[model samples]
Target: MDSRDWGRFLLPYEQAVEELKVKFKTLRTEFKSRDEYTPIEFVTGRIKRISSILEKAKRLNVPMDKLETGIEDIAGIRIMCQFVQDIHRLSALIRARKDMVVVYEKDYITNNKESGYRSYHIIIEYPVQTSLGLKPVLAEIQMRTLAMNFWATIEHSLNYKFKEHLPSDIKVRLQNAAEAAYQLDQEMASIRDEIISAQQHFEDKTHLVSRVLNGIQDLYYYHRIREAAQFQLKFNELWETEDMWQLKELSQELQEALQRAKRSNS
Candidate 1:
């Protein structure tokens, strides 16, 4: 296809990728807004290059005229998670969505590739509106843990550098490296609960500290300079102790002080 034809053909696929990325990212934000543990850590999307499309189509024996139905990954979305389990959770959520139809799934995590590549691949048919009409575009969503993604990225680069023919020694090393990455994922999963607890504690303390500081600032805005100074001192003392209870008490004290200051000023 000519450049113009290629651009026109890929436009709907690009739109599908962008929309899927936004939808998955919004899931992460919505989960956090509810103070819940989100399966998705981050999302990324891309459209296959023109050269790549041609190469794959040639390899798959797909006619240029039949590229739309023959190419499943013209548009791709990648979602990364902190734990392996999160990959499954995210995939299940995607399967339940109405905007897209799930075509198939490849569970590479359980049945890893010989090259040691591990990820969950979900093929979906997404509807994108064009000037002509609504177009159904096939897109692939790859879900993996952070470690798996890191390993896969390096492996991809190496494969490209070697033109899919790495030296035997380097291939051995890459396999070993993949195993190490998988081990890291397993270790992290084992302590996932503990890690999550610590993270939640930090988040809670951060919000509490913010509320206390805002209260002090409100007091200063009310012309209660003395009260604000006192609040600052108390916060400093509690912060140094690193005691959550003391910080909580300080936050309450500042909130009540701010209310009193407002009443007195009125």
Candidate 2:
């Protein structure tokens, strides 16, 4: 394809990329706000290389129109997650979207490549409004955890650096690193319950502290310094108590004290 033809093919691909980015940004905001899962970390799109298109066309002796209409990977999206569980969660979210229909699905995580590459791939139909009206287009979505992505990225770089023929020693090293990544994933999964329990404990403690502090500040603002000071002194002593159970008991006592003060003022 000439430069002009290549530009024409890229225009739609670029537009589709922007549209998907906007979609993902809205989903991220929703997730932050407890609105939705939208478990997509990132989305990327690109037009196929002209040489690749030419080669495929030559190999199959297909017409330009047939190639463009049938091939879906001309536009792509990549979703990144922090944990492996997030991949399954996000894939379900994508499948549930009314605006997108799943055309294909591939789970490379379970069936990792010989090079130890792993990820989930999906093809979804996204509608983009054009001068002719709504045009349904195909886009690829890849989902993987941060570790998987890190491994794949390094592997890709190595593949490019070696021009698809990496030295056997380097290849072995890369495979070993990939195995390490797999082990890390397994370790994290095994500790998932303990990790979540600790996280919840911390969040609960944080929430309790915030509530107590805010109440104290309100008392100080309302000319109730005596009560506020009492709250501060009690909390300080609780901190020095060196026992979490004792701290909980003290916090409860302070909460009751604050409630009494509020009732008296009212």
Candidate 3:
């Protein structure tokens, strides 16, 4: 097809990728606000380039008119996780979503490829509303741990650089790197609870510190400069001491002061 035709055909796929990215990003934000354990670390998406799509179609023996049915990943989304378990958790979450229908799944993590690739791929048919009507676009969502993604990214670069005709030494090195990455994921998963607990604690402390600092800054605008300065001093002392209890007490105190300031002004 011509460039104009390709653009028209790809519009719905682009919309599907954007909508899915937003939906997953919103879920991550909601989980953060609720202080819940979110399975998603981050998300990214893209609609394949016209040239790449054409090449892929040619390689797969897909007809121009049959591209829509034959191509599963004209649009792609990648979700990266901190742990291997998160990949399975996110896959289940995607399956439970009502907005998209799961067309098929590939568990490469469990049944890894000969090239030592490990990931979970889900192909979903997402309905995109256009000016004309609803168009169902097929998009592939890949889930992987950070380690696996790192290895896959490097492997992809090597394959592209060598045009898939890698020297034996490089091929062996790539396989070794993949195994090391996989072992890293396994080690991290073994202590997943401890890692998650540490992360949650850090996030909580960060939130508390931000709230306290902002509250103190707001107090200065309310003409409570003296009180604000005093609280700032207390916060500095508590921060240096590394005392969690005092810091929480300071946050409560600052919060109550903010409420009083708002009430008196109202």
Q: Which candidate's lDDT is highest?
A: 3
Q: TM-score for model 3?
A: 0.97
127 in model 1: Cα distance from truth in Å?
1.3
**Superposed model 3: Cα runs more than 4 Å off:** none
Residue clash pairs of candidate 3: none
| Candidate 1 local distance difference test against the native | 0.91
Candidate 1 C-alpha lDDT tens digits along 20-87: 99999999999989989889899999999999999999999999999999999999999999999888
TM-score against truth, every candidate? 0.95, 0.70, 0.97
Which scores higher on lDDT, 1 or 2?
A: 1
- lDDT string for model 3 (210-265, tens) is 98899999999788999999999999998998788889999999989989998988
Ranking of all candidate structures by their lDDT, best first: 3, 1, 2
The models' CA-based lDDT, in order, is 0.91, 0.76, 0.92
Q: Write the per-residue lDDT of candidate 2 for residues 172-209, one digit (tens) a residue.
A: 89889888998898887789678666765776677667
**Winner by lDDT between candidate 3 and candidate 2:** 3
- Candidate 1 stretches with Cα past 4 Å from truth are 261-266
- TM-score: which candidate is best? 3
Per-residue error (Å), model 2, residue 209? 9.3
Error of 2 at 236 (Å): 11
Worst 10 residues of 1 by lDDT: 253-262
